[model samples]
Target: MTSKPFNKFRIMMKSLMVCTALLGTTFLAKAQTWHFGPKFDANYSTMKGEGIKNKFSPGFQIGGFAEYNITKHLAIQPELLYSWNSYKKSDDFLTYYVNSGRSAAGNNVNLGTVSVPLLLRYNINNFLSVLAGPQYSYKIYDDEDLIKEGKEAFKNSEVSANFGFQVNLSNVGFYARFNKGLNNINDIDDRYEWKSSHIQVGIAVRIK
Candidate 1:
């Protein structure tokens, strides 16, 4: 049986897919103004909450992005990404888990997820632009650092706000973004709330 949170995440992803298809159909006539590219990124991410330490962990993302230019200065961009997000466990947390018989527990929380970010881009010049948007992430992999008694320790789906800027030089673009979870991700308890955040620095290569 699937977990309730996982089921809910699947539903949300399906809804997002339908909406994206409808939008694609509507904008097919203007496809000439669209651009597509592959993106690779390195990130430093950490989970923040009542009990966990905030030590950052290294991660990465591989993905593609599509953009529709609405004007010389404005565009809509959507990205599909597969990312590894990691957060380090604190000394105290590790000690507790070790005492509880989970002696082999890892020192970091490793999560693999697929994410979609719909952003509005504002170009200030040919080489620079600012972007902001909401990102949807659904977890597909977990290290289970927080799991206990067969119960999930985190929510399967997360909503985040992303803010950043990009620099373009011909077909190569470089960017940096900050992502912050907008909702509590702690599924195990009500006393200690959890939120995740990450910083990404990336390079994008246009293919179309």
Candidate 2:
């Protein structure tokens, strides 16, 4: 890669690290009242746009989170995760026309992302809480094959909203959430805007 793109990547990475460090500092300030642990998430994801196929593509996430209690009924939680997903493109107009002589053999893309979510939690009861937040995600890897086909590559970063409910039992929790993209990731064409959507189901274990 050129120095320009490499510098951009470095800047983005530094920004993300700074944000994580700030969150950790806040957690430490409330160390006596904070709890943290690891989490695992499974995602069924899809995209919507012109000439796009929407399907439930599978993805996985692994990460850690910290919760700081502000009151009996309110808390703030922040998470950092590494996520991976695979999506398929079928019957695309550009694909069909670009490879007129050849057969359509493969059209799968794997994406790796670094995700950060800062959530505000409202405790509805002892066993349940509702969370709403904004998530920041940066693409770390994208399938080169898809990019070579003149397809529009996904944006380097994405911002989205997350709404979910969690059920807690002692130190373990189960959650289900919907992630809705707020910005168009499609830069290839101006006719249609592509947005992402995901269904996330996950389990979290509090170790401290």
Cα error, candidate 2, residue 184 (Å): 0.9
- Candidate 2 lDDT, 66-167, residue by residue in tens: 998899999999898776656666676465335321134256655667889999999999899999999999887665344344454567789999999999
How many Å off is the CA of 114 in candidate 2?
0.6
What digit string (tens of lDDT, one per residue) describes model 1 on residues 150-195?
5556689999999999999999999999999999987765666789
Candidate 2: segments with Cα more than 4 A from true spot? 1-30, 95-105, 149-152
Q: What is the TM-score of each candidate against the true structure?
A: 0.80, 0.80
What local lDDT does model 1 show for residue 188? Answer: 62
How many pairs of residues collide in each model?
0, 0
CA deviation > 4 Å runs, candidate 1: 1-30, 94-104
- Residue 111 Cα positional deviation in candidate 1, in Å, after optimal superposition: 0.5
Question: Which residue pairs does candidate 2 place in steric collision?
Answer: none
